[model samples]
Target: MSSEVDKGSSTQRKEGESKRSKPILTRSVSQLAVAEAQHLVLWKKPLSTIYHLVQYMADNFVYLYSEIVRNKIFVFCGIIILIGSYFLDNIEGPHQALFDAVKKNGYWMSYWTFLGFLSSFGFGTGLHTFLLYLGPHIAHVTLAAWTCKSLDFPEPPYPDTIICPTQESAESVVSFWTIFNKVSVEAICWGAGTAIGELPPYFMARTARRSGENLEEEEQSSAKKKVQELVTRFGFFGILLCASIPNPLFDLAGITCGYFLIPFSTFFSATLVGKAGIKMAMQTSFIIIVFTESYLKMVIRLIAGIPKFGAILEPYITDYFEQQRIKLKLGQDSNDGGLVSFLLTCLVTGMIMYFVISTINSLAQQHLIQELKKQSKSESKKDK
Candidate 1:
C-alpha cells in the first residue's frame, strides 16, 4: 500500500511539472511570434501608408477635380502660367534679355532682387533664403573685408552695397550696424513672405470652423498641444514671442489663432514684427559676428583635430571655405544650378503640390457633405 501511494504522488508531481513546462514553451513561442510581427510591421508601415494615401487620392480624384473646376479663376491662371512658361523657355533672344534685365535690376537691397529668394523661402519647407542666398552674401562681404584689408564695398548686382557706412579708417571692420543696414530690406521681405505663408493654415482652419467641422477631437502631439495652449493664453504678444525666436511650432500658433477666430490684422502684424524685425536682426547679427571674427574657422580647426572623422570633415570644410573665397573673388551669384539648387527646386515643387492637394481635398469634403445633405432632404420629402 505504501509503495502504491508513493508511486501515485510521484506520478502527480511529474504531471504538474510537465503542465508548467508546456506553458513556458508556449509563452516563448508566442513572444517570438509577436516580435516577428512587430519587425514586419516596422518594414510594412511606410509602404502601407503610401498605398493608403494613393488609394485615398484615387477615391477622391473625381470630387477633387470637380471642386478645382468650380474655381474657374485658379484653373485659368494656372493654364495661362503654364502656356506662358513654355513659350518663354523656347524664345532665346527675348529670354536672355529678360534674364539680363532681372540680373541688373535685382541687386541686394532692391526689393525686386530678393523677391525670388523671398518667395522660395516663404513657400517651401527646408528652403530658407538665409542659408542659400542672404547668409552667403553676408559671409562673402565679411570675408572680402577681412582678406582685402580695405572697406571697399562692391557695386550692386555684384556684392550688395550697405545703406549706412560708419567706418573711420580704410581698414574694414564689419560692425553690427553695418551688417544690419545691408541685409535689412531683404530680411523684411523674407519675413513678410513667411507671414504670408502662414495665411493658408489660418484660412483653412477658419473655414473648417465656419463649416461646423470640429478639429478639436483630432489627436495632437504633446509639443503641438503646448504651443496651441501658449498661443491661446497670450494672444498677440504670444504670437510675436513665438515668431521672434525661430520656433518651428509657429504653424501651430497660426492654426490655433485661426480656429479661435483671431483677427487677421492682429495675427499678421504680430508675426511681421516678430519675424522681420526681431528674428532677422538676431540672425543677421550672429552671422556677421561669426564670419567677421575667427570663431567659425577656429571651430572648424578644432573639429578637424578630432581623431578619425576629423580627417574626413577637414577636406570638406576647407573646400567650402575655398569655394566661398573664389565666389567672392569672382563676384558671381551662388545660384549655379548645382545639386543644392536642384534640391531646392524639388522641395519647392513638392511643397506647392502638397498645398494644392490639401486645399482640393478640403474643398471636396465640404462639397460632398453638402450633396449628401441635399440628397437626404429630398428622400425624406418623398417618404413623407
Candidate 2:
C-alpha cells in the first residue's frame, strides 16, 4: 500500500512539472489578444455619438427639458457657474483665472456658440454638426440660441445658414443647389480631416520599423497581418461604413489604411463617398421636412390623423408648425430669451450627448470582446 501511494504521488509531481514547463511562446499570443482587447475597450467609442445623441434629444425633447428644470441641484450648480463666470469675465485677476482656465482646458466661453461652424472638420465636440442638422430644421431659433447676444453679431445672420429658400422666391434654385454644395463640402472636409488623423499612427508604425526602435520583426509582422486581414475582410465596404457611421473606430481603419500604404486615391475616394452619402441623406431630409411646405403640411396632417395618439398630440403638432412658421419669418421671441432657457437647452443637450456616447461605448466594447476571441483562436491555431 505504501509503494502504491508513493508511485501515485510521484506521478502527480511529474505531471505538475510538465505543465509548468509549457512554452511561454504559446501563451504570448493569447496575452497579446487580451491586451489589445482591453486597449480597444478602454477607448475607441463613437465620439460623434455625443453630437447625434444631443440632436436626438433635441428632436424628442419634452420630459428631458422638464426633468432638467426640476432638478434643484442642477439649477443651483448652474446658477453658481453662471454667476462665477460672469464675475470672472469682468474681473480678470489671476493668470489662471476661471474663464481663462476653462478656455485653456477646451471649454468654450464667450462667443463659444460660433465654434459649431468650425466643427465641419471634426474639430470641436460636434456641436457644429448638430447645428448643421438643426439649422434648416429650426432655422433662426437654433442659431440664435447658440450665438451670444453680446457679440452684437449683426442684423443679418451668417451667409451659409441652412435656411431653405422660400417657395415664392426665385432664389429657390440657388438654395436647392446650396443643399448639394453644402453636403459635398462637408463630406470632403470631414473625410480629409479623418484621413489626416490617421497619419500619426501610420507614421509611428513606419518609423518604428525603419528605426528598429526595439520593435521586433514578429510584432511588426503581426500588425501588418492584422491590417491585411482588415483589408481582405471588409475592403471598400468596410472603409465606407466606418466613414459614413458616426463611429470612433474609423480612426483605426484609417490607421490601417495608412500603415498598409493603401493608394491615397482609394482611401480618399471611399471616405468621400461614404461621408457624402451621410451628409446628403441628412441635408435632403432637412430640405424635405423644413423647406418644402407641401411635404410639411402632409406630414402634419398624417400626424394629426393618427388614431389614438393624434388627439393627444394635436396641440403639440400645431404649436410646432406655428413655431416653424414664426422661425421662417425670423421673428425672435421671448421664449428664445433668458438665461434659464439657455441653461435648459444646454442641460438637455449634455444629457442626450452622454446617453448616445455611452450606448456607443458599450457597443464598441462588445465588438472588441468578439475581436479578442477571434484573435485568441487564431493565436491558438498557430501555436498548435
Candidate 3:
C-alpha cells in the first residue's frame, strides 16, 4: 500500500511540473515574437513593409470607410471634390464648351465661378494654390505686360483665358495698382479657400478637447508647445500673426486654437484677415514688383549666363519665351490638355490620397489611446 501511494504521488508531481514547463515555454516564445515585432526595420524590407501596410488598410477598409462617412463629413466632401475634379478634367466635347463659355462670360460675374476651382486648388492643409495656379497667373500677367505693354490681366485657368487682350490696348500702362486690382479677386478667393481648409484641424482638436481628451505636455514637441503658448498669450493677434506669414506651421495654430476652445467667429475672422487680406496683398505686391520688365530681363540674363549648362538651357528658355509671346499675340490657351494636364491631375490625386490616409491613421490612433485609457481606469476602479 505504501509503494502504490508513493508511485501515485510521484506521478502527480511529474504531471504538475510538465504543465508548468509548457506555460513557461509558451510565454518565452510570445516574448520573442513581441521583441521581433518591436524591432522591425521598415527600410530593410520596404517593399514587404508597404505590401503589409496596404494589406492591413485593405483589411480594415470597412472600419475606415465607416469612420470617414459617419464622423468626418469634411473629409467626405473633400474626397468627393477630388474625385469630381478628376472626372471633370477627363470629360470631352460639351464639357469643354461649357467650361470655355463660363471662363469667357461668367468668370467675374459670379463669385462661385471664380471661387470654385481656385478654392478647390487651395483646399486641404498642405497644397497651396499660390504656387500652382495663382503664381503662374501672376507670372503670365507680368509676361503679358512686358510683351504686350498693357496690364493684360490673365483670368482664372489663365494663360488659357478665352478673352485675351486686344492690340488696341497695347499702349496701355501696366502700373502696380492696375495689376493688383486685376488679380485681387482671385487672391481673395484663394485665400478664403485656404482658411476653409484650415477648419478640419481646428474642428478635430476642438472635438478632442470637448471629449476630455487633451494632448499631454510630454506628447507635444517643443515647437508645438511654444506655438500654443504664443497663441494663448496673444489670442486674436497671435492667430493673425501666425496666419499672415507663409508658414507651414499654421495648421498647428489652427489645432491649438481649437484645443483652447477659442470661439469660431474670432478664430475665423482673424484667419480670414491674415490670409486673404495681409498675405495675399504681400504676395501680389511681391509678384508685381518681381515680374516687372527690367527684373524679368535681369533674371533671364542670369539664367543664360550659368557656366556649363547655360548654352543648353538658353535655347529652351529663349524658345519658351518666344512661344509665350506668339501665344499671347494669337490669344491662345497655353495648356495643351495632354500629358502635362494628366500629370498634374495625378499629382493632385496623390496628395489628396496621402492626406486621407494620414487622417485615417491619426483617428485610429486616437481611438486606440482612448480605449486603453478607459481600460486602465476600469481596472483601477475594480482594484479599489
Q: Against the unseen true structure, what C-alpha lDDT does each candidate score?
A: 0.63, 0.49, 0.67
Candidate with maximal lDDT? 3
lDDT of 1 by residue, 1-384 (tens): 999999999999999999988556544543443343333221355454344445546656976888888997999999998898667756787577775666454553355234423433321342455665667666666666555444455444334432222233555455656656755666676666666667766776788689764453334689888888888889889889988888677777887888898899888899888877888788777877887647778777898999998988777766666655566555545765444446657876776565454444434434343344446447657987
How many steric clashes does model 3 contain?
Answer: 0
Residues 253-274, candidate 3, lDDT per residue (tens digit)?
Answer: 8888899999999899998899
Question: Which is superior by lDDT, 1 or 3?
Answer: 3
Question: After TM-score superposition, what is the CA distance of residue 247 in candidate 3 from its true location, in Å?
Answer: 1.0
**Model 1 regions more than 4 Å off:** 1-126, 160-173, 326-384
Local error of candidate 1 at residue 29 (angstroms): 38
| Candidate 1 global CA lDDT score | 0.63
Per-residue CA lDDT of model 2 for 1-384, tens digit only, reads 999999999999999887765434435544564465444422453454344344444544775678777897988899999898777678746744666657643432222223222333221223334443334433333222222211122334432232323234333232333444433433344344444444444444445445433221233445446544665478787676666665444545665665555666677677666754664355444653454455556777787899998777666756654654455445344365334346547876885575444554444443454455556668768988
Global CA lDDT computed for model 2:
0.49
- Candidate 3, residue 324: lDDT: 71
Instruction: List ranges where model 3 is wrong by over 4 Å.
Output: 1-125, 152-164, 170-172, 216-222, 305-311, 333-384
